[model samples]
Target: MGPESAGSAQRSHVDRLYHLPMITPQGGRRSAMVPDVEVDFGAGPTTVPSTMRYVDLTGNGRIRVPAQGAVDWSQLNKLPECITVEWSGADRGVVEAVAARQIRFLYWHDASGTVDLTGTGVTDVRLDGIGLRSVRLPESARVLLLREPPESLEVDAPESGHRMDLRLFSRGPDIRIPGGLSRVSELWLKVAGTVSASVLTGLTDLEELRVSFDDPPGVFADAQDLQAHRGLRTLQLDDAYDWDPGNLPELPSLRGLEINGTRRATATVVKARFKATDVRISIHGAKSEAWLAAHMSNPFRDWVEDSKPFGAAACEAYTRARSAIEALAPTASDRMAVAEHALRGLIAALNAIDAEYQLIDTLRREQAGEVFFELAAQAEVPVDQARRWFADRDF
Candidate 1:
């Protein structure tokens, strides 16, 4: 697939497309050490004026250069706090020239052809565009980002104690997370094709993960079986419904789940299944009450109507409980009296039942213990009794 689609285009083009004139800072000497410079590029020929306008991005010690065509930063020998270069043209000698500046942190934004970084000395670099050649990346690289998927990727870096973050949007076949990418703590992947779960198998130390699939049928059929990534704390899934529900791996540290493009009904059911897993789920998009009711733990008349057994000695009790629970809001006169009374009677009938209902067993088996506890609390009954009632029999 080419970059013609809306979702698959380069991020810079999607966000900010530069068409203005390029500005190259020019100054012979300064009294107090010059910290940063802002360079902007246009479509015309390269012009290095003796003086140019100064623009600040973050209002700090960082250089923000947005330009086109070849760039030369060879004069900057002293490393600044940070350097950001945004260009749409590739220059084979630009990396060597920038290396002479001894940059500490670099933000390279390019949309043209590939640029080589064989001997660049930047400790942290965020490479943008799709033509990045990783073989030339220095071993001193600590933080890296392929803003877009690369045609050729080479994993080379020293064994430093620093943790790295790798973010990329890739739809290519040749790109793969190199096994040598050690100490990677955060990984963000936006994919468009089939990918295996094993790509993330060895990333045990990963703490944050965000994955989005642009394919309609979903490409991560193999990624559904998450293989015990205990360190993962935050997982955001976008348009990823290829994985089967109820098959998620046990993540002890996982606490936040952000999901998009998943049906609300499925999200509700899955959230109930992981209630004991203690994850805070945030489902995006519109939601309906029907989806919410499908996963409710409380026994209702609907279940009885569906030929599902309820723990009611009298059918009227089940009917009453169902009506009470389903009511969106009670009238000011009745308030919750109708539902509360129905619940008391329903609990009494349930206590007298000797046979077990499949609904209760299903709730317990799915680890939706809190739902029952909430029901008990709403019914003015003890939670311990509800827990014991749920634990009474097996399905």
Candidate 2:
């Protein structure tokens, strides 16, 4: 047996220890450093004067570029740059300090505008970031930012050909913003830490996507599976126990996916396959029935649900405990005194049990069946033996 096979029996540990690509600083530089290209930026260009260099103009921040004649932030490099300016605060009369970091610009192809945002010449403006809320281009129209807790940067513009990169500080990972993104192909999300979004619903043509989050400050969902990315060929979802991502992308053409986290991505059931593999994948949630079928080479594999038995058991226990406590309600008797004491005890115990299960989910991977394994581990028991597990699952 090779190193992969020899490690099979210990896959439970290996499954938790997934392998992901190490992002280099140079990789991040692409998104950070503003390109030095010289655009003719004709007379009408929303251009930046030579004096608009990076400066501590604000006297309090790292870098600031004050727009000269209607600042065109679209010319910025594909990275996180803080646009330090001022805006109206909640109290309209108050002058609020505004810093649009992780801003994005999208080519407004629909209703075109003029050189300025007044009529029909300035539609050339393009900004698209998750943290972007209301940025009126020309003056303060180009940059966007998440509401609170700063994030690094994430640009998912697959068509832009921009690499999956960003300038991340030690504490980075999430950017909250508006939903419904179907037109703009360039996607950027800052799940810098855990203060972020759960599902990226709009990018349908995406062939590959990589998400990085604080392993513990993860986001959870009600039911949407991420693998729903219709034409995705690659996926990388990593996080900690706190990261509660719902479903894995249910992609059929997925050639590879690299994942890391505490909870099993609930959406692992969509039938999918890949052209090949590069970075190893580590799955822990309810892996899709179609995935095993492809891996085992037995397209007819009957798969089992990989829900955490511990979680279910705890849930059932809580239900029973609640019913029992409710039964002792002093409704039909004059035992109101004991009822109060009993009810408190029941509530406390139920809460304690719930906490216990949550800890288990954090400390280790949810237990799965024998045939199942994380994508990261190498095949050991001949690809055929694994295929058999899928066939016998139904019976």
Candidate 3:
């Protein structure tokens, strides 16, 4: 398909905005470093700037350039390992500049046209809201996350001892696995159309695989092809339709299997097939209430289990929060409002018990955020609004 068609598919597939956290210095302070000679791209041609603004000097070594002006990179005294450029008109010169500096992580937003990173030392790359028709990656590239699949992709094999992680979230039916991605260890394909057995041809080292169909009638062509992936440990299938699990290979290394939004009969067959194995299976959507109650436990129960005598207050607080959310009327506005209130209550309870440190020190804040999002999703809350429920959180 053409870029226009692919772009349309992307919009439908990803209806939610992802708010990625930026790395900042401790105490939430940021110092701006302006370029030595700031040349206006809108004006006549001039020398490339030697320095750039918004360079994170102290923390994780990052440079964030906005989409307003042209950035012709010049040699800097200190180059950051992570660079984020939010320009839709970035071209080959930008790629060359980044390649020369050997950036480690690159987050390019709203990039357009073609760009090649032939010999860059970048280990991780994330392309979000891109309009590129093609992209070429160097052999040193390890992790690639694409919000929209490009019309053409050329990825060289990773260096020795390095494995690639390829994630593509596309709604197009023409999503093809590139040839040189044989070293990919983790693959996530959230797309449409039939997934042929040839798609797994060289993915022998794949450890984790997740396939989610965006449209109905899209199916996996063959289950026998999965036998080659002996290292596969985790497999997730979401919104799967017209797919059979009866002939699935016996993956001895499989530990976690999840099948969501599929036919109830299919789910039952899968359960029966893996009932004797040690694999932890999770089947949801179009399932019985009894099955759901038995399989899906409270999100905070694990936290309560991990904490003992000192966690009594936290357990009580989380229990109340869960109850509050569960008691909300099945309305979007009510869910959003009640979820926000419950989250604030939980945070207050934590602060009252002098356990706020646990939220930060033990990463309980992330857990709490995920729990709230899960509850919100279950209630059909829009992801963007649900995400904002935690915006005013104190803990």
Candidate 4:
């Protein structure tokens, strides 16, 4: 037989069941002996062609894969491991800035009532003034900073890589560092909030730090009183963290120092003797704040007991909401709805809070208008008081 005849005869029993790559054009002929380019083993042993061979296989052994006309499973095999996944558990989010080796820095704006950022892989988050309920950074994260109040920004060390800077943006000097993160490989820590007790338990290995106190009470007076930063060689005390300049210390190993007293520390005795090292002491409170720091009231008196970890704005909002509700008349209905809606489902729990504002916040996010109307319609309370209470709110 000729080559064409042999080819046609061998493809007589070729079937499309098992594997079908492409049907042969010759198989369209009148003779049943025509060959088929695409063929499988379903046609029995007689369908075996002399061409294309299969990978090593024998007996009942089977490996379901995408090869030799099988379905492709490469995508499934390429998925990253579960450990590299970040789960931002909370609903409301403000993923202001996100940077990763796998993707470009994703800067997101928050306009939606509820922001969801559960898909950011192995999150390395950095944000400021974002109104998020919470954030969870993966263990693969290098640097996970919650510059804004993130309610609770949980960082599982190995998930992120924050070698450059980790800042907690607060208008004051107070912050909470996770106790779990025993060692911070980061080089600089500029906290814009209060540095409460044990909050620095995680920064045993930081190289440089500049912490601001939300409460400029000057209680953190002595640097020696601070939980020592073993690797710390430089320090910066903003007006929030400064006490009396005399109380400040200049370490022998200190390579750089910035004692930003501005004007707030001038009255306190916040002296810095950076005689031996390369320390830069900049007084940045009154003069440094050459411009006055905006006088903003504290927000948290109930939601986050000064001891708790959460966002300052969250507390501030709650505080404002409660104050407004107190000044409001009980008849306000629309205002109540706005507050409750803002709470979504936390209205009841918030109401249970001793600080009436927590519950009022639920109302604020819901129908705060109701509260205002009620207050306005009331004849008993002074109307001017209610007006001042809601002066800063969006209504």
Candidate 5:
């Protein structure tokens, strides 16, 4: 038999499943049969004849295009499939053309540099480490996995249509989420710097939110920011264990709350506050009684009490350290190390004061003698002054 006869016999199974169109002339069909491309898309296996310059595996509803320098989709008649566009070289036109074909899913991987998916009819997109500057996700977009920051990002949402459920992993001191796309239902932001609450102001209809706060106050400052989210149901506060219950918002719509890194005193208040409320609560890293005992044993807490004389000394130390750190040039690399050391001292002083205050507050509320004497002896003030202060107290 001739080469064409053998090629036809080899491709007979794949041809029956997916017709591999011809790209070469009938005379040269013999040489084209040398290399056949096999692809698997869940169902089983199918091969493309070497004769065709391109293959259309979209018949099975999935397409995996390797990183070719440039691809002509028109060669395969532009089938509507969930296209996986892997990073090869610059192929803006190829991506645009595929999007223009109104494909439902676009899995963009390893493609760096600026990418603009403005008019893409893609509904679900999984983007990995793409330097996305101009991002205009279609209103049809429902799910998105954005794992890296674009130099600049702007989402152009369709005026009247479906909303997007986005998971963004971007870090910054000034992270900007465009005011446009307001239909985000669920948003999970794993940010490095403190993200302003204003970023989510327009997403009023948001239901679930998970965020990491370098400073929890940034999110708690505006009550209306979370209160305005009438549809909000779940909120996960990551790295907010140090947060006090007083800073927590009164979101009537909130049903589930998750808090991590909670101090024992703060955790107690949080649990008490949420007990009567319908919101289900979960707490992690809550300090145990032993943790409280450890603090009580420290002499610094006793010395940092609300006594006016102690306050005066503490204030001077804190102010002096802060001023010394601030005097250094902000741009200097050594400034951070100096500032960090100064801040450490300041934090220790502040923590001592906070522990003393928390202990006093707990004693006032619970009226337990054990709470008073635990750190009362550690008070750095004169023994006589400490006695007078503790004796006069109604605990």
Candidate 6:
């Protein structure tokens, strides 16, 4: 039959059985059938019983369903293992159906209102859009990404060996990470509103953390709580306004720390606090002597250490360039002259090295360019002027 005629027949079939009520797992009643639906089980669309009309099985035990109207999903003979639902409004039956079947992975998009999966066995969930009033995930969840901030959120502690990597974009003051979720190992929070770092109290196992804010008071409220994560190895804090770094404890495990767009005092304090440690610190927006010294100590340390036997000349050139930049005077004009001469010398040295070793490939050239610009930045050369500084280079 043609598509229109088949659709009409399907509607007629569902209309005849629309009066039948299906009992949900919660003991509530809802319509047994939805009309004019096709199930695509990976291969192609196929006709299914009217009672299973709204659900489209897309193979590998994954199903796509709509949340626009009331339909009793519990009536299905078999439920898919993974489900993606585009929700328009609150549907307690949908949540109950997922909970009843223990859906493993759920991608709920364009949803609003509250959804509490407190007792479900869902392991992976990705939620998007705004207007979420509250959400509660079960302890079984291991991977979660919330694209919009919900007003209230609660997540149970994740099971061991199933560490969760959570990324949250939050702008609501009410949103806070519960201490119970201590097993979160990697977290990224991009905030526009205030969020307390007290949330990090019990996340002792966190190895990497990144926090960025949108405006003043950009830092977390009680950022000192970060010290609790003794295992944290990498941290990036951006747009930190008036943050006091003195309270930040020394993290023995920290190998890399990047602080960008912070106040001068905070940057200086961070430089002082982490200098003696072997941590690689990258601070942006501050041209203080400390920042320059920390970054310039050896910009080419890795390259020099890993250089091949044939690349001795290139390594020496890199070392010489670094030395010249480090000795630059504090004045901008003196810095410009010293940096330009050092860059020219490095270029000449690289040209001679490439002539003999053929080492200046596209990758090497890009790497050299990055190092050059970083040196320029360290010299306090304006970026536009720095670009022109390299205009005459031959290498």
> Which candidate wins on TM-score?
3
Q: Over 4 Å off in model 6, which ranges? A: 1-88, 92-105, 109-123, 128-140, 146-153, 160-162, 193-195, 263-273, 283-395
Per-residue error for 350 in candidate 1, Å, reads 58
Give the winner by lDDT: 3 or 5. Answer: 3
**How would you encode candidate 3's per-residue C-alpha lDDT over 1-395 as one tens digit per residue?**
11233322332232221222332223233334533343333323333334332233111233333445555365332434324333334553556666777456666766666556766776667775546655677777767777765656555554521377788777665666655577678888877655665576766678988887655544877877888888999988765656889768888899999775566678888888888788999865543444334323333322322233324566677678778877888755666677777766766775664443242222345656766676667656677776666665555
Off by over 4 Å in 4: 1-102, 106-123, 127-141, 147-154, 159-164, 169-175, 185-194, 214-222, 264-272, 285-395
CA lDDT, every model vs. true structure: 0.50, 0.32, 0.59, 0.38, 0.51, 0.59
| Clashing residue pairs, backbone N/CA/C < 3 A, model 3 | none
By TM-score, the candidates rank as 3, 1, 5, 6, 4, 2
Deviation in Å, model 4, residue 228 alpha carbon: 2.2
| Window of ten residues with lowest summed lDDT in model 6 | 18-27
Model 5 lDDT on a 0 to 1 scale: 0.51
How many angstroms is residue 154 displaced in model 2 relative to the true structure, after the best TM-score fit? 18
Worst 10 residues of 3 by lDDT: 11-20
Decide which is better by TM-score, 5 or 6. Answer: 5
Find the 10 residues in a row with the least total lDDT in model 1: 14-23
Q: What does candidate 4's lDDT look like per residue over 116-215, in tens digits?
A: 3444543344444345543444434454455444445454444243443455554434456543355665433344333443455655557766554434
How far does residue 135 in candidate 1 sit from its true spot (Å)? 3.7
- Shift of residue 129 alpha carbon in model 4, Å: 13
Residue 89 displacement (Å), model 1: 5.2
What does the lDDT read for residue 358 in candidate 4? 27
Cα lDDT tens digits for candidate 6, 1-395: 11233323433433332211212122234356534345542344444434432232222123434334345465343433223333334554656767777466666665576667767887766676566655677777766767665445454444631367777766665556633456778787777645677766656569988786644456567767777778889887755655567667767788998775555667777888777778999875443445334332333322322234323566578778878888987865666777878887787777776666554543356657877787778777787787776665554
